[model samples]
Target: MSRVGKKPIALPGGVKLQIGEELQVEGPKGKLLVPIPKGITIENKNGTVEVTRESDKYAALHGLTRALASNAIVGVSSGWTRELDIVGIGYRCDVKGNLATFTLGYSHSIEFLLPQGVDMTVDKQTHIVLKSHDRQLVGQVAAKMRALRPPDPYKNKGVRYTGEVLRKKVGKSGAGGKGK
Candidate 1:
C-alpha cells in the first residue's frame, strides 16, 4: 500500500465531491476537476475520501491520484497563493484591474495580463501576491513573471520568489594574475 494513498482526505463543510472518470470537487470558493487514472479507485466514506489501487502495477498512480485529489479539495475550500518580490533600484510593479505593469529598469515597461481565476495584488510596489483556486495555475503565473526578468547572478537584480536564495558570482579581480 502506498503511504500517501493509504491516508484518507477529510471533506470539510460546504465542500462536495463527485467521483467518476474524474473527481469534481466543489466548495465555497470554486470547483476543481481531477482526473482519475487507470487501476485507481477513489471512494468517499464518512465525509472522507480514500484512494486505492487494484494492484501493485498502479503504485505510482495511487499516490498521484491521492495527491491531486487532496490539492483539489484544499483549493476549492480555501485556495492557493504565490508571493514574489522585485529586486532592483528602479524595478517596481503596479496593478490596474487584471493587468500588471512592471518597470524593471527597461526602457519600456512590461505588461502582464492575469488569466481567469487568478488575482494579483501589489504592495509597496515591490511585493506581489497571486491568488488562485488552481495551484498549478498560480505556479505557472509566478514562473512566467520570474522568467520576465530572472535574478542577475552577479547583482541579484530582478524578480524572484520571496525568500529565494541566490548565489552572487564574484566579479573579476584587478590585474594580479601571473603576468610577465
Candidate 2:
C-alpha cells in the first residue's frame, strides 16, 4: 500500500470536488482536472477525499493520482505563488499588463509575454512575483525567468529564487603563479 495514496485530503471551504473518470476540483480561485488512471479509485467521504489502488501493480499510479488531486484542490482554493530576484548592477524587471520587460545586463532588453492564467508583479525593480491557480504553470514560468539570466558562479549575478544559496567561486589569484 502506498502511504501517500492512503492519506485523506481535507477539502477546504468554497471548494467543490467531482469524482468520475477524472477528478474536477473547483474553488474560489480556479478549476483544475486530475486524470484518474485505471485500477485506481477515488472517493469522497464527508469532507475528505481518499485514493485507493486495486492492486500492487498500480502502486505508482496510486501515489501519483493522489498528489495530483491534492494539488488541484489546493490550487483552486488558495492558488500558488513563486518569487524571483534579479541580482546585478543594472538587472531589473517591469510588468505592464500582460507583458514583462527585463533588463538582465544584456545589450538589449528582453520582452516576455505572460501566459493566460498567470499573473506577475514586480517590486523594488528587482523582485518578481508569479501567481497562478495551477502549481505546474507557476513553477514553469519561474524556471523560464531564471533561465533568461542564470546566476553566475564567479560573480553571482543574474536571476535566482529568493533565499536560494549559491557558493561564490574564487577568481584568479594573480598573474605571478609559478613564474620564474
Task: Give the candidate number with the greatest TM-score.
Answer: 2
For model 1 the TM-score comes to 0.95
Candidate of highest lDDT: 1
**TM-score of each candidate structure, all chains considered together:** 0.95, 0.96
Worst 10 residues of 1 by lDDT: 171-180
lDDT of 2 by residue, 45-164 (tens): 999999998999999999999999999998999999999999999899999999999999889999999999999999999999999999999999999999999999999999999999
What's the lDDT of the predicted structure labeled candidate 2? 0.94
Q: Write the per-residue lDDT of candidate 1 for residues 1-180, one digit (tens) a residue.
A: 799989999998999998889999999889999999989999999999999999999999999999999999999999999999999998999999999999998899999999999999999999999999899999999999999999999999999999999999998899978998
